[model samples]
Target: MPELLNSRVETCFQQAEAFFNRPFKRAQVSLKLRGQKAGVAHLHENLLRFNPQLYRENREDFLKQTVAHEVAHLVAHQLFGDSIAPHGEEWQLIMRGVYELPPLRCHNYAVKRRSVTRYIYRCPCDGSDFAFSAQRHGLVHQGRRYLCRRCRHTLVFSGETRVE
Candidate 1:
């Protein structure tokens, strides 16, 4: 079924073929590339990445639009060159004119949100409190200090907050 998505990309590549009247290589779909984003296209690498989480949640759109979206980026890069702006006229043309898909800048998939534990910290200067993500909290627990940009004072961990 993954290959089915690649076939969709090949269909999009063929559209680029007719549009530019030149050869366009097919883009491959990668499930291993994880990100908060729904998809990404590496024009130089000839690769397309779909967030596996997004893929699982919205397989229909993932197949229908995500492949075409990323393929349009590659086709736009081939026609317009690296200096061209991403999601500019060239990409939009391939997206809308060629693929017949909406020239949307991003997707609206419902990705799963993980519960995060935040550490609350305060600066002594003004008694202002700030929340730190788990990664930042780990750094603080490792004896790293974060300074307040406004007060120029080291922020100390005051408490913890769980975000769901």
Candidate 2:
């Protein structure tokens, strides 16, 4: 894990402890490529399965948001048994009171964004342009070829460009 992520996790843990009025035992945190969109939480097993891509991709806001979401789940389970509603009013209150986060909302993890340039492409037909931060977009249906949905044209991958 990155140093920044480690710090965020620690901060989240402290915040959760303060809200719960109890000390939280050490727990494991790891980054995953994809996780269930339901919410972030402490997983007893398969810690790496917890997707950090959300936080890694959107470092600024997501790091805190995801940490808060997972911390809420841990706190809820600790206070109330699993019988309580996963997303009940109590959870919402904890999210705000403990983590100082807004109400829960849907998160779209599939949205692609550009950070540093790993690859560049241009649409052959309409001259549209696209850039990818990662080596691959993970869309392998057509063997690394991406067709422009709008123009229905093949995208030609150009060599990497240095982005500063």
Q: Which of the numbered candidates is closest to the native, going by highest TM-score?
A: 1
**Residue 143 in candidate 2 has what lDDT?**
80
lDDT of 2 by residue, 1-164 (tens): 78877777678778878767787655567665554452456444413224555666667766667666766666666677667776787778888888888857566556554446555677877776687655554453348777898887777776646573
Off by over 4 Å in 2: 35-39, 42-49, 109-164
How do all models score by TM-score?
0.77, 0.57
| lDDT tens per residue, model 1, 1-164 | 37777677788888789877899876666776665788899889988887877877888888888888888888888777999889898888888888788888888877667677777889898888798998999988898989999988899988757575
lDDT of 2: 0.65
Computed on alpha carbons, the lDDT of every model, listed in order, comes to 0.82, 0.65
How many residue pairs in model 1 have overlapping backbones?
A: 0
Worst 10 residues of 2 by lDDT: 42-51
